[model samples]
Target: MALKDKQTEKNKHFIASLEFALQGIRTVFKEERNMRTHSLMGVLAIIAGFIFRLTTVEWLWLLFVIFFVLIIEIINTAFENVVDMCTDFHFHPIGKKIKDMAAGAVLITACFSLIVGSIIFLPKIWQLFVTYFL
Candidate 1:
């Protein structure tokens, strides 16, 4: 193919790849309960950020931790699927260990996000309470 044709083909492939990724996200969201929960948490965090009127740096930190937890959860889900496939959905100690580790990763990231969220929001919440309730 010509150089211009190759560039056009690459662009087409990039768009198609993005579509495939989006489709995967949709499937995961539909099939995985944890994904739905994580998505809900992310939405709640966004709402809290708006309510608090977070500063730009605080917004960046909040968004980063939210997405970090979600990305880890997605990876954990993928690991679970792969482990299940590899073990033929049967009992296997190694497979159990792999799945456990993946879950632990998700848990750790979630805890990290919780800590970051507390750091960012607790003061705002306290101030609001003090201003209104005290």
Candidate 2:
């Protein structure tokens, strides 16, 4: 009986956790600018994958990179907002460092995604050119 009660409690907690997660998703879509940008990037990435005729594995890798950048951007934005909320004054070295570090993370992720995209697409483009005109 105790084991069954524990299992029931666990199920209830899981359902409540899922509800909270859904609310978070709704709030992210409703209020986050970075989320909007990420959504746009996701759409572009899907369109590009189709246009480039990527193999299934290559498309998976490309989407991974795209999602990785967006995830990093969202985390970075969250960090910045939290820092800003905690500090309202200018010229605070710690605050500046925190924001700078977060921004640097986003920049690094963006550069990495760019490199992955180039590596995946450049060869295919060259081959298409050769097949068409050479």
Q: Which residue pairs collide in model 1, if any?
A: none
Q: Whole-model lDDT for model 1 versus the true structure?
A: 0.91
Q: After superposition, how far is residue 97 of candidate 1 from its true place, in Å?
A: 0.5
Expressed as tens digits, the lDDT of each residue in 1-134 for candidate 1 is 77775545777799999999999888889889988998899899999999889999999999999889888988998999999999999989999999999999999999999999999999999998999999
* Model number with the top lDDT: 1
Count clashes in each candidate, considering only residues at least 3 apart in sequence or on different chains.
0, 0
Residue 61's lDDT within candidate 2 is 83
Cα misplacement distance, residue 65 of candidate 2 (Å):
0.9
**Highest TM-score: which candidate?**
1
Q: Every model's Cα RMSD, please?
A: 3.4, 4.3
- Give the TM-scores of the predictions, in the order they appear: 0.91, 0.74
